[model samples]
Target: MSARNAMAAMLDELMGPKRNVELGKDTKVTFDDPDICKYYIVGFCPHDMFVNTKADLGACPRVHDDNLRLEYPKSDKFEKLGFEREFLKFLSRLDEDNQRRIRKNLEKLKANEENGQKKEDLRKLRDEQEIARIDGEIKLCMAEAEKAGEEGLVTKCQELVDKIEQLEKQKTAVEERLNNTATIPPPIDESAIKVMEVCEVCGSMLIKNDAQCRVEEHLSGKMHMGFSKIKVTIEELRFDNGSRGHLLMLLDISVNVKDGDHVNETDHVIEIGEGGLDRVHEIAIVAEVVRATDIVGMIVIGVTGTETIATDDIVAK
Candidate 1:
């Protein structure tokens, strides 16, 4: 962690919940207190998740207490207090900022890929030209050695031979490098290519066809966790609503409609008799209608928040 972040964390400890309760002073703190961190009470705090990252939000300004967080759900207000909304709104803003950053990075990467390949081609062409020039020099030296040998200047001929040998070695090295540079790597699978995408949850730019472990690590990272927590909390609030009490059941319904005698839009009135009640065996909820009930008498109910519904089979608890 950076020095600044470390100090911020230290201050959070000294001045937050630790100061309020652990210091032995009588502190009458409640979950509803403005000083208490509501984000922590609802779930994970976004301020704590992004520390030392480019998205670092610094330390949470409010006090974080495990006791207070536990007490929050049991409070009279709970979801009515708007703590979840506040937390959701803040995280959403953070993600929005991150999405902009991700878009910029994508633009840069696209431009760089083209430019980088052009640079690589230029370098290869230069290396090839150097090898050709060196080969020409070697040929000239060989000609000189031939001329000197005819004149019986043995010493000069030998020096020319040595120079030609050195040039040949240089040419060989360049050719080897050129061959290696020209080599094509094995093709990657198309299925693997599709896996890489901008993470909608955390607004991160993931590597294209990254290693499995690295992808797993990214999925489990703090930023991902921070964003994923939003969905979990929303689901909790949804299920916590109706009388069925968050029940999940395996349902198989085949209904024959008789007549739509009366119209009750609040809950569909299913005339499927006693068998429907036995299958669900749970409290009731709300749903929509499919006109008259003759061949379509099934008033199948889907659970939704803050609405109470009744049917012949399922009763509101």
Candidate 2:
């Protein structure tokens, strides 16, 4: 399986089943059947009433009070240290086996980070080595030009100098990246990062915050709509065998009409469902059968004459 799919599966296993917590009238705060305090799971729960007033209360913590209602951390704070702290707290709450699973996932992430760093270091080393080689070549060319004092040798030496200068500039840029401590951010544990869920319709992975909007957009998209239409057509085909023609017409099928059998635009009446055509407006034959494989049959077209005929509307005749 792919790395992303594996990680998703591991995350699903780690999270287990979702709790069925119901939100009260406020909607901002969840109250009913709270198996675990949301804030406690996130490393903090400041509801002192649960501790002081109800010392031995068996029921869940009541967060209905205006002061007690938990507010989500600011987006910036969550991006910074909040996620890591909360995830650690969550790990602490899990059983030994669950924690072991989480730790294994974390180790894999750390190994990936190390591997990435090693590759980047190797690339930088190669670049530096290339720069050194270029510098040495430039020096050798300069010595040859000086000794020979030939026009061609001088030109070659200048070219080498120009090439070395470019290499040196690149080397300096690489050095800057290597030396810039401020630009080097601390390595973060991948487990601290929020796990994303895959969209069932589009097969795209998305974070919880943007999942709803993405899912709605995906459902309304042309590809999804087309698939939905195809699904409906299949269902219709299964139930209404005689009405298959209507669905086929919707798809703009090309029928092969028999040889010598011709349809007159003025004479034939088009019937769609219970309605009949008022008049036969126009008929244009796109192609005549020039091959033996082409079907040769009477093409009976049913449509309201006033309706506009598309290029795809013409069937074989």
Candidate 3:
């Protein structure tokens, strides 16, 4: 329809087969077509440019750098001009009806050029029609192949069916798992395990077993709510008989109050380190302590941040 398009159509009619043959490397030419030259010749694929310094054309280039010029076979003394021959062969075999139609349109286009209509528009229409014909032929070929149950065609269909069945099975399994998990209530009180740490020094109510954290402060920096710890310290305090009560009590840290409770600032219960010298640091705890006589808690404190740190026995101070 458009002038440029019409011109391309005319060019294709005259040159399409020649071009295809040239691309097939049947016919030899001193110079490559400008468009093909731009891609295959001037533009160098980065990968090839990097490794192969040779001028030989490989399958493709490795790199995609913009600066590289394309390398093409352009020599005055060339051997195989098969490209041009092959192109001419294809062009000669072009559909006779299409060719006649093209010639008629071309004549009409020439007449119209004199009659005030642009020649370029006619050329574009002819090219578009030719392309459409080719496209239709290709579509027919594909449909025939599909109908005949070609190997790849059947394989592709089977693959798609298998994929769909797999997806359906996965969906069913996931749904079943969700239903089963739903039937069993998620642990209401189990999630606090990571946030739970018992003080080895104070000998908290936690059942002590591993001697790795004995007679030392539980180096758990801070436990989340509902996690408990026992803090213990011996201070030489002058009591009524010249002896202090030696306040050694296990502090149970928990979310003891709900959000609306009076002491609820984020609802965390305040037990130890709230008032008096029973403050957090002064306890002089054998950090990370357990009831074992041999092990200490400070050992855990030494390697706290590691995920799978092995515990060692605490050396009594």
Between candidates 1 and 2, name the one with more favorable TM-score.
1
Q: Which ten residues in a row have the lowest lDDT in candidate 2?
A: 284-293
lDDT of 2: 0.41
Per-residue error for 289 in candidate 3, Å, reads 36
Q: What is the lDDT, from 0 to 100, of the residue 8 in candidate 3?
A: 58
Local distance difference test values of all predictions, in order: 0.61, 0.41, 0.33
Cα lDDT of candidate 3 equals 0.33
Residue-level lDDT for 51 in candidate 1: 75
Indicate which candidate wins on lDDT: 1
Model 2: runs farther than 4 Å from truth? Answer: 1-96, 150-167, 170-317
Q: Report the lDDT tens digits of candidate 2 across residue range 17-67.
A: 231225443333222224335444333333321232212123323222222
Q: Which 10-residue span in candidate 1 carries the lowest summed lDDT?
A: 243-252
Over the stretch 1-317, how does candidate 3's per-residue lDDT look in tens digits? 46776565456434541455634566433234433322222222222321232222233312122222322234432213233233222223322323454465556544644653344356445545655554555555455556546656776655555554554565455445444534434457653222222332221323235345632333342221102211101111111111011111222111133453233344322222332333233233322232212222223212222322222333233
TM, every model: 0.51, 0.26, 0.15
Tens digits of per-residue lDDT, candidate 1, 117-226, equal 78779878988999989988988999999999999999999999999989989998888877886453334854422334567667677777789999899999877776
Backbone clashes, each candidate? 2, 4, 51
